[model samples]
Target: MEERTRAYLRGRFGDYYRRTELTPPPGANEREWGFIPWTSGPGTTMVRHRSLLDLGSIEDFLARKRPRHVYFSAGRYDEPSASSMSEKGWRSSDLVFDLDADHLPSVTLGEDSYAEMLAKCKDALLRLLDFLEDDFGFEDLTIVFSGGRGYHVHVRDAGIQGLEREARREVVDYVRGIGLDIDEIQTKEMRGNTPARVIEKDGGWGSRIHQRLTALSDDLKRMDNEEALGRLSEIEGVGDKTAKTILGAVSADQDVEGYTENEEVEINYEAISAGNIELGGVGMRKLIDAIAEETVSAENAPIDEPVTTDTNRLIRLPGSLHGGSGLAVRRIDRSDLADFDPLVDAVPETFVGHEISVEVTDGGTVELRGDSFTVEEGVHSVPEYLGVFLMARGRAEKGQE
Candidate 1:
């Protein structure tokens, strides 16, 4: 099982390492070990005296692998006091490195969907990459496997000292954006008989932007295909139908510049790519406006009538979300506050910490990033309790049975 997990980690995170974490002895509370003074800076060393994997040899692991980034993360939660796993709930789904508790949705979907959960994992990472590349521009992000079922992605370019609290906050929002998309995962309303292809299934909106950016950050490698699509489908203002329209244009390889905002939208990637420099805003706008209207057909006019690619550029749009190039947001700063350690004093701070985030780029492509590695459980948690319950009954009710 561990080996399979390791293989998946290596495949998902191009640059990363797997390390076991040590903790306090059998009976000692993690608090007994004392704290590692952290005002948030690069190269602040952490201590690990006991664990599934040893931390004492971490330097050797890094030296051997020569990885660019080292991220820590995990899927299970251990006993709150000692950082032990024996007494905790077996979490099927993971929260990963979102320590701040900000952006933690109140939704309790313990059984509604597993595919949805996995897709969310991917989208969360996609959003993270978007922010990391656009906002920080930090390069060579690598993830680490900190044992257990979690993972982390480390930005080797910026150590702890390099990452300020504000930057951490941005990361948290990015992650939340990914998770927030859970509200829109493949609902009944999204499927349709008319669902021909929107964007090419493999190469869609996010992929288009991802390919456009050179020096793709290691942070982006963590995103899987399903995650990217989840994000494309959940672009806030770009409802299901419209998001598909925009994605189709991108898949068709249309240049974003040629896209005009009007009642209808149109685009022809082959035309734009051919250097039809004359195809300016007016032409682009007309195409965009006519995109969704069935009434606006080739009968009125066709680019072929003028110049082969000149007026042939109109690509259709959905009547909804993709109506324009505009995007929408409910809370900008709300997501930004996600990663702050509001309860730093309460948790042990030991970690297998990997995470995901969201970022906006290219005015339309919302990117998600998965902190591509793992960190173990810290020494402690503040609330003094983790939600757990066990009950027994003499009789089984109809639904309970």
Candidate 2:
């Protein structure tokens, strides 16, 4: 960082420490806190056996060290040292979920790409939230925008505090939809002269399957018969004849019989027999498997599995600045999440009114607040927030004007 940038950051930290509310992790006195102070040459330094007595103590520490980044352990410890986990005598920990857009398929890192990637990340976070709340019944959750590429969900349910590594992995698997048996979730039944419809039961993964299918049905309805048939035929076991029959049945809103009251709705299987589509249970299984794959792919949130499973994970402290992004790690209220714009909302108020000149070293277009600007190899006067963000990214230098 340049001298001017460093000075600006230090000044911001001074204000932040005074104004920002800092909440120590549960069992804070027993957990280790890590800091990457501006004076620290390159890496973070872990401060152990050092407990903050109150918010004033936290502010005092920040004023003294002026760390570029702050983090605390997910796990509580008796020893609170980095030397050995076994010696630390680990206690209960929050179940942490890290959802990063970079982990999602086709995400690229650049200013031009950030908006789309952020949207993708928001979608993933919402899905994960649904899974956590509706499926797992977890109510005590904290959501934070990581101030860079993703969000974090911290589950602090008392009942889940004692969950072991394997149990944690099971929760991760459920969120990722890994090792889910499609057959167990969906069953196929034959109606006279109808296509074999995959019937989704109520509750569990069944609800998700139903949601996906309903969306798919709406999309399929928008397409012409031939288009619907073509898309359906792309599925592994769905032949042209079967696809046509299925499309016809779906288009006609044909309903299947034998489904219990508990079942949401039955897919019509009469289309298969009507079209003389001869296939065994294996073929039916394949079609259902295809639907399952589609549903999972569309709905599953991409999260760092290791982060969630690791018992001793250290998560970024909310309200601290992300060193790489120069943005505040913001704690988001559950109700405000849908409207929270990280790029705009996570910016420090200290950077709001000030404007700085910077020379773009790497060319790209970036949108800040609501305005978009094309960045190229030249000096530009921009909001202090943008200047700091560009400087942190190593894409811009302090411009000599």
Candidate 3:
């Protein structure tokens, strides 16, 4: 970045801090704070190992420094400002999960637009929430848009604070569905004369698989006999003969006269729950394995695992501006998350009311503030927010009036 561009952003950032009231994270004084200053050259330097005491007031420090980026450690410490890790007393850390659009397997880089990537990241966020809220029953959650690539979830439930790194890795494994075995989740029960392996519908992975099985069965029951058989055959390991047997097993209980739709549904559920699907030559185990694989692929959240495991990781401050995107690293209310558009909502209100001239350097299409347009190499007068965004991203530079 040019010196003029750096100076302009530094000045604007200071102006933003002057007007913006940022709420510090809980126990801010006990956590180590860090910021990257607007230094010259291609490489940036991180000014870290500082605590809240060292900065005096957060607002004053930000206005004075006008840093390129700001962050706070996830781990709380006794001596947060200590110059070395050994000197800083190790304490508990918040369980943090990061969902980066660049890391998501569902996203296709170079092909997916920024909007599409963010949409996919939101889906992953919801899935991660399911594990945190329903499966783990964790409350006191804080969700924030990282102001650059994705979202961050901070789980501050008191019970998890003191957990060791290994314990945290286990949590990461569960969320990612690593080493998940269908047999481990199933229970053996006697169904008539045969001992059957049944999935407990109480909760957890078993409940998820059961739900998928129930839905699949409902759809199959609505189809014609031939169609349903054809659909069943599409599943791996289920050949024509196996498909016929499985279909018969699912329909065998439907022999009663005047069976209602609800009754058919119940029968299907019973078959799945009791594990009584009599696949003549093929075993129900193979079918369950296939469905379990499908369930994991569909439900697992692909979070950045290292972020969750690292006890001393530095994460972006919620209200600070991400110098890379010139967007607010904003905290999001859980209720508002579904409607939140990062490109629109994260744009700083500090830069919204005016226009500025910028000379586009590495130009391309930019989608921001609910508008999408292409820019080619030239000097253009655009919204101040757009100009700031372009300059921060190094795609443009400060232009004279």
Best by TM-score: 3
Return the TM-score for each candidate structure.
Answer: 0.24, 0.81, 0.91
Give one digit per residue, the lDDT tens place, for model 2 in 48-145.
43334422366678766777778887888777754677887888889999998888864766542788898889989999998998888999999999
lDDT of 3 by residue, 139-213 (tens): 989999999889999999999999888999999999888899876787766767788667767778888888877
Q: Write one digit per residue (lDDT tens) for candidate 1, span 154-221.
A: 34342432333345444454433322221121112121343321212122222232222211212223
Error of 1 at 393 (Å): 18
* lDDT of predicted model 3: 0.85
Q: On a 0 to 100 scale, what is the lDDT of residue 250 in model 3?
A: 52
Report lDDT per candidate.
0.26, 0.72, 0.85
Off by over 4 Å in 1: 1-119, 126-156, 170-401
- What's the best-to-worst order under lDDT? 3, 2, 1
Best by lDDT: 3
The backbone clash count of each candidate, in order, is 85, 10, 1
